[model samples]
Target: MSLPRARFDQFRLAMMLLTRLPVGRISGAVPAMDKARWAFPLVGLVIGGIGWGVFAAAVTFGLSSVIAAILALLATALATGGMHFDGLADFADGWGGGSDRARTLEIMRDSRIGSYGVLALILFSALLAAGISEVASATAFLLAGVGSRLAMLLALVFMPPARADGLGRMAAGKGEASLIAGTLVCAVLVILAGTTGAFALIGAGLAMIVIGHSATRRIGGQTGDVLGAIQLASETAIWIFLATSAH
Candidate 1:
């Protein structure tokens, strides 16, 4: 395929995988997850735009920033079908409830949520809302959305998948092109934020590194749930960083 066509297909794959938005079918064979990683930040752009729109509309209607933030988060969650949230909950349950790697993976595979999962959702959701309310900038919202997925791609590239099957495995390897493309897109987006961008970068990067290390040690590699957890943690960190540094 030609370069432009290849990129388009990859984008379609990314959108199909990442969000609930119904972009039409890809023209031919499905691309690998790695091939579509380049477009993950683009998916973030769409998600962030929806969130910003909702927040802007709410604020225009005289809603408090707190309520607007909640509304914005709800919009994004609907856009993505709450996939990341589910991942965070599964990862928390698996990581906290299991005594061994095998047991952990098994727990993650279960459809039920546990106490750790509940606590994780509560803590992260609260932090995410609080951060959004405090910063309340379009740039901050977009950065959190875009930067967090960029962090997820980075995790996908750097860490080995914990299981032989599933998304983490499918997304690994063949990622050099994705790494470059995603970094370029994320870099350009970051430049829009000035020093706050730098802080968010550092914060998100550190969160990814920590998650990578922890995932490696606990489960021996990354999983889809771990990637989702990474996104939530990275996004929260970005917003918190922005909230602290915003002028």
Candidate 2:
């Protein structure tokens, strides 16, 4: 029998929110990681939608572009409970502080943040904020929302699971068809936004591929934390590219 469509939608919504969506909360009771994997991109769409709305509001308010960008960034981080930020920090700490791959992974898994991780987080966050501010166009910001999430989708497509039994492994390889469907949808959204958006999407895709390859080579596979790091890096990369392209 086919899985229920409603259930699938719920799963998608849940995966996007750091497993905090209502669909995810319900699914949490049943414990199905395979469903969660397929649902991730859908969840990304929802998150992107929220970010787009915030950007729209900022633009409508006639706030300074920098202030609008800062608000949008904060909305994303807060909505997701800084899950991706944590991943970004951990990955930075691991890669920057460790001498080898094993040590790096070990360091990433640790709860403590090192100086390298802190610096990386600060730098990345500032770059993203500044980049978004420079764009100053509602269309560009919307495209950015879509582009960043598309990067996350690409990461899921390219990376392998780092651990045997964690969330990453469960959701790693199950939904190529679903992910492709989602990417196509995101592409349409980007194209609709403008030429600049199209360029941002292309840049984000390339960055994701490069990052995925590097992460896989370094650690042999992707973890949930790696997925988070991918999203954070890709989002920042998109903003940076858009900002430069705009100038």
Q: Please give the RMSD to the true structure for each candidate, in Å.
A: 1.2, 2.8
- In Å, residue 101's CA in model 1 sits off its true spot by 0.5
Q: For residues 19-66, write the lDDT of model 2, one tens digit per residue.
A: 344433343345355555545555556666666678779888898777
TM-score of 2: 0.85
State the C-alpha lDDT per candidate. 0.88, 0.70
What are the clash counts of all predictions, listed in order? 0, 0
Per-residue lDDT, model 2, residue 131, is: 89
For model 2, state the Cα shift of residue 224 in Å. 1.5
Clashing pairs in 2: none
Maximum-TM-score candidate: 1
